[model samples]
Target: MADTWTAIDFETANQDRGSACAVGLVRVVDGRPVERHSTLIRPPDPVRHFSHHNVAVHGITAADVAHAPAWDAVWRRILDFADGGALVAHNAPFDMGVVRRACAHTGLGHPAIDYACTLALSRRTWRALADHRLPTVCAHIGHRVTRHHRADADAEAAARIMIAAMSEHGTTSLAELSRAAGLRLGRLDAVTAPTPVAAPSPVGPAADRFDHWRRAAETPMPQACPDADPSGPLFGRTVCLSGDLAAMDKPEAWRRVAEAGGHPARNVTRTTDVLVVGSHAGVGKTAKHRRAETYRERGQRIDIITEAELLSRLGMTGA
Candidate 1:
């Protein structure tokens, strides 16, 4: 946890994690941030179903990227900016997933990233804060941030918060502060840029099946948040994930949910807190999760995240 690194934020098209359409980078060296970069990346998939909610956030649209470079085109720049540094973000695994998808698409070697999450660091450093959300945290620290969902502004704000935290905590060097922030690089590759993954035939049974589901229904809200307050939707509860978070690593992201006074349960049952669905989720488990259905039908509290949207939710936007 003792290294200077770059922080990144990705905004995706709609709700797909694999659909990173824009990225931002902030490089911090010697505890002072330098080198901010951002670019719109065209996902291989067209950004259909663009949401008003999302458009309000990042301001990206099909029109904006009518002729932009694909994710394949701009990934090298992202990798280069991240060179020789641990990748820092609010949610480490989410950004890593987007990076993984970009790698998978290009057939490139997945780059190793040392990680430091402001999300995790917030819990460690700011025990008095009400919420660790970017804007909330920034407001608590008295930093004026305008855009709530853009990638660059958020990344810069995160970088500033990191700098302030280090100063407040009195960590003289990047290494010292990094360790305190839980910066960890496990078996990370030393290379700056990786060879791209070869193109997959964007056509296949899995792709077709997944597409069919998207084309069929209005793409149902995946699953509900899955926690019900006697009064409202998980207003003041805790939800946890154990075993596996499936894809996008639920435990890592949901750590914030738990820290926020939402209790996360290790086991699923009648008394279980919430069920976070992962890629490894099974229909049998769904069948067993009758609680989810019951709550959904009654308009209680429920939440589910697809692997990709989970990653997207974790993506930090300056917007």
Candidate 2:
């Protein structure tokens, strides 16, 4: 098994990936966590606020981080702790997004780091589970997690899960385990140049185009029927879809959201509960996406999920 790896988890103040209010980090050496660090951070906003929904999930409020250090003050220490070792997280994208966006917002250069996801590894390690959420996977592997959203506990749990997977697969290194699982390690670096934006293409079929809602008068609306299960995965949530989803058409995607008891929104706002970004979202720097990021920066709760994750939540396969 890999002798050293850093496991990280971030608890955001809102839907914006940059609104990271707390971080939990665990450094594992010889397949065991030897160092653990967790801290509350005052988000980058001048007038930082904490949403009730976010507070409910993590029990962290503005008052809790009023005296805490800002991300600029804390990021160096985090980098020093990682010390160039391979990084790991339950949902690698979300935590890595926090690092990248917070750096961008504060005008700091991102550190070059390679990271892996336990969530992806879990799918390969344990294929029998219906869902591979952090809590569910942690429980399956006999790791006790007392606090679901707490950064420290979650990070520690992720470390243990990685250790378990490595042992079960008889892998001697992170690269070996990643290869065995058919996962590509992700990387982040400071941007040295701007990317050119491609010209927009003609809108596709009405069912496939995300902007079809704009011409609703000409198209029949999908009936707004609530899901039968009040406690469905997305119950009482307002989900907004962004980018081009490769797996399904827009109408079918919206129907799935409603079927899961979530209201599908065309735009992202303070009221939007979730933002499902598709694979073809293309860097996610669009106007609506940026607006949603700003809402999160202001301390409004919004859950930004991947399209594959949304499908998993809805118990559907992309195929």
Candidate 3:
């Protein structure tokens, strides 16, 4: 809801957050988008392989960005385009992750830009929608995202959605809008390295719990419950996890997966059927997630879902 801010989106060449292939930015001034910019980028070295799934999503193949400028070459232009305004993005974490990881990979300094997620804001604004995906939210607010995956179109759609949310709530500023929505403005520096599960101290009850959790996460694939409902969403699926879940520890999540008749694996594999992506808000995808994308690119049927979706599938919507 800032009078002047930027809505941004990035399309990746593959699963690596650093593998940015395209970027789009829309600058909104005084509640209206007054400028737009987009560019194709050659992803950083060693992570530039264009996966088939990613290409199909945005239709940007390696050939398309074969001659494009790399992240280091275009990052300054992107920063200048934003003009010191906070960024807004549909899934701000992913887009921001792209920026952070790309910077780290290219040895560029982080741009210290704060951002807000339209996806999160839309959830607070329109709670009745069955799903709060970009396209669905856009449609609800009458902002038709004709080109869903294209970076430019998605950026524009996110901008419009933010505008609509601000108007709907009668909020005149980003802070006000965020307060109304019960969320905080996210910044890139807010993201931290993954917190490793603690090692047991062998002396206290907390240590015992930690030990149990550590084993659960490190356990080999467990047998599914025979009494589990066969028609359940996760039934018969091979599920793997990535990142840290805010709802529950990995052990609890894995136990629930097994109880729901899903085979909970310790890692992503060709045979894995679903990758449940968890949240450490502002954190990026994990190696398992990247591997899952690779498998999907190779035509494997794997669903990379959010922890909320996983809970929904496990019939634990609010648990």
> Per model, how many backbone clashes are there?
33, 1, 0
- Cα lDDT tens digits, model 3, 195-299, are 222221222223365564566656556588654544456778999888766555565567667766789888898789999887543557678888999888889
The residue-level lDDT of candidate 3 at 59 comes to 94
| lDDT to native, each model | 0.57, 0.73, 0.76
TM-score of each: 0.63, 0.64, 0.64
- Give the per-residue lDDT of model 2 (tens digit) for 1-319: 3467899998877545567899999998877789989899998673255555467678998899999999988898898998888889876756776787777667677657888878767877888887877778888989988988899998998898999998989886788887887766767765534232221112323333444444332333344344223434576788888775655445546755664457877778778989887655365466767777899999999888887888777643321
* lDDT (tens digit, per residue) of candidate 1 on 42-157: 77553333445456667898788767788766777876887867777665545665676566555556555666666656655776765466776788778888976678887887
The local lDDT score (0 to 100) that residue 213 gets in candidate 3 is 54
| Residue 237, model 2, lDDT | 81
What's the lDDT for residue 77 in model 1? 82
Looking at model 2, the pairs that clash are 16-296
Candidate achieving higher lDDT, 1 or 3? 3
